[model samples]
Target: MTEGVPATAGSTRSTSEKTAIFWLLAGVLIPLMNIVGRYRVRGLENVPEAGPFVVAPNHYSNVDPIVIGIGLWKSGRMPRYFAKASLFRIPIVGAILRKAEQIPVERSGNPRDGAGPLRQAQQIAAAGHAVVIYPEGSLTRDPDGWPMRGKYGAVRTALDAGIPLIPAASWGAHLIMPQSTNRLSLFPRKSVDIVFGEPVDLSEFANRPRDSRVLAEATLKLMTAITALVEGLRNEAAPTQRWNPTEHGQTEIGRFNDKR
Candidate 1:
């Protein structure tokens, strides 16, 4: 809500487009999720009303994306995600991604596809839109659902675009579907909560080259913001040190057993 901090236009998906997607998707998902659990959203006003902004959230469960997407959709911002290129190759889903113009990220080091999504994110933001990114890249490995370490994509895109970055936190999503599994459980309806925090002040870091030093500092600050929000939601303090997958020899993108 600060001056010169947020955007001045709706997401690239015009109001009608957002509505169409919202109702179209919600009509099916709302009732399905409601049957599974209730949703409680807070601090939506903290979301930027205009321009290109980044929504950075901690990842914990598969359903959380749907929950977050609904929250953002309700706030008039359609989200573009940094989905894996493989998912974009699926049949029906791939068709949707192509039509929506979502960004595809290549996790492998093919050199040819390096940093493709990050650069695309900057261009998307520059054109006046919003993107939702999981700074952790994937679900948390913290058995207790706390946010682990963050990647640089979200913060880098914000800094590169000179746009406000909002840190979002969600709790009770892991309950919708257990960790490391996609099996849906609707027997017990749970409460899914999502909150959006104030934009991280990175004006000082703007215009700086994307060096290791700058990305590291910005990544820490961004994670700190997101962790604080999750801490508030959980009403408990997070560990002083973030859990690092590489250091622990765990996978970053999927199940720990995943060697990739």
Candidate 2:
């Protein structure tokens, strides 16, 4: 634990709100996470002690959600994610997700359907829970693991809900679960570092019309803050230009060859 971090044990939600499955999963996952990787968390004071807030972190691996979720949990905030709708179709997994009240995101191409997930996220955040939205939408296609161009979903949500948009960064989780494969290397435990930064300043766009240009700029600002935290954790300089899948002829979603 770092200085200035909150000492609260559970999330912002009351004990009665947490479901049995949520606790069961927490019990099994938290201990296992500790066993697999040594974590050093910082900037806990940035997380709000109460009320709704948005956590936007860089996405690089399938394990990121778990790692970030644990980070939020340790910071005394219940983390809710916008998960894929298909995940809700799995047998036991779907049941558990539903019981835990995780929001399902339907990625239908229809622009009309797009608003549904964001609406759900807004509702969740309004209820005083932390909503974790990966601005990159999927794992970074950047060969160096730097965060690529981000989507506007995270920025839009925070702006619509009028909540704090906190930029967070996590480094070294890829060592435990690389983007290339699903294997877990637990023998030699890796060091995973997660840092939370101050809430992004979106006041300029608060009253502006939510046009594409404005939203894109806000997303870039959010991504820039997240990248800075990642740089501090890794002690390395990111590329001058952020990665863009479209420019590189890569699909926005799903796994693709990282090699250029």
Per-residue C-alpha lDDT of model 1 across residues 1-260, encoded as one tens digit per residue:
42344453454444554645446666787778888887788888987666678999989888788888877866877778888789998998887776666798887745356378888888777767788989888888776778988878888787766678899998987888877678887777888888988888886677678897998898899899999999998999999889887776777754544322
Model 2: per-residue lDDT, tens digit, 1-260? 11222223343557544557767988988898888898889999998877778899998878888899888878877788888889999999899888777888776545576688899888887777788999988789999899999988898998887778999999988998898887777868889999999989888888899999999999999999999999999899999999988888787654546656
TM-score per candidate: 0.90, 0.91
Name model 2 segments beyond 4 Å from true.
Answer: 1-19, 108-112
Q: Pick by lDDT: which candidate is best? A: 2
Q: What's the lDDT of the predicted structure labeled candidate 2?
A: 0.83
lDDT of 1: 0.79
What is the Å distance of residue 38 in model 1 from its true position? 1.2
TM-score of 2: 0.91
Clashes of each: 5, 0
